[model samples]
Target: MPVAPAPPAAPAYADPQGSLRASDADRDRIADILAEALAEGRLDAEEHAERVEAVYRAKTVGELEPIVRDLPAAPGRTAAAPRPEPVPAAYGPEDVEGNADQLLAVFSSTTRKGRWRVARRTNAFAVFGNIEIDLTEAIFAQPLTTINATSIFGNIEVRVPENISLRGTGTGILGNFEVTSLEGVDPQAPLVVVNGYALCGNVEARPKRGKWVVDLQSKIRKHLGH
Candidate 1:
């Protein structure tokens, strides 16, 4: 029957293993490698940030291969030698006193701005109201701060500094939950994790324009000097 229309050519990949789908653990491994590369001066801040961002966006194993092809072999893989641990950066005091752990807004707008201390975990609830959390000038008392936001027919907005990493694992049901994942240059920068749900409402976390953690390294140095 017309020579069976000839057999279709098979798709190909540089490495057969690359054709596999990448799991969350695979992405995490790659991120760790990039962090190590950044710490070891193998890759600059921009490169590290870009690669890390790509790592999160990668869908298939093939997509992750090129990201770390030039870098040293990842852990558990064949390598000439083992990699060394990076020195930890000094952090400022984690002032948890007087920090608000729960923010509720019902039919009114609630805003948390200016200089303040961020607790290890904060919950924001907006029921038929609005809640705003700005961290550009806020102090982080922990390396990892989690924000649990719930919006029921309302809105919750979170603004973060540009020098800190941001992550979101929220969902939306007949609503919108959006968070732009960002990887900051400083490896020691605090990580802000947003996790919650939006029910017929909206929740968003993003970097405020022209806002950054002023002199992060200098602040760390000053903290160490004390």
Candidate 2:
């Protein structure tokens, strides 16, 4: 008599009760579903944003289930294969050498904006002039970027996209040092840290309105011409 064939092994994280811990890939998949819903007019921008935020905050598969339970099933999504994590566009050491890491403005206004590669660390100095560093349309070479700003009788303003994280550890001496801290919903979003001093001048860091980083998966798909 022939023996019965062995039972198929369960898929990874195929808990019928959905009690397994969620991974980054899990969150990303749920986020993609929400994005599709928004695009189809099933969810408004506000609702989509809120659900995306929840997707990142979910710690378990159970928590992620309710986020898109009402949405239509995603196309081509299967449990047979695990979703791959997104790889962001990063600059290598050779690429870093080509990007400007320092900005100086002495008695003249200077600005660094548009589609530029940002280094891991940047130094900005403003003396009796204005220096503006806009990262709304910039490419992040790394996950975290530090900006060392110094203003002496001048001004230094740093603008970042609204969807990226922003932090400040700078101080003001007989001047103003202001930074509007923000925490982004996407875990893969870039982080900007501003640190330095402002002496008899102004140093400000804030999010640029109506500017945001595209969805990580969406960006990757576009790069692959999908």
* TM-score for each candidate, following the candidate numbering: 0.60, 0.56
lDDT of 1 by residue, 114-217 (tens): 98878766889999999999999987765656688999999999999988888777789999999988877777777676878999999999999899888678
Tens digit of lDDT per residue, candidate 2, span 102-165? Answer: 7999999999999887876788999999999999988887665768799999999999999886
* 30: Cα error in model 1, Å: 18
Model 1, which residues run further than 4 Å from truth?
A: 1-91, 95-100, 221-226
Clash totals, every prediction: 0, 0
Best by TM-score: 1
lDDT of 2: 0.75
**Least accurate 10 contiguous residues by lDDT in model 1:** 89-98
Backbone clashes, candidate 2:
0
- lDDT values, one for every candidate: 0.78, 0.75
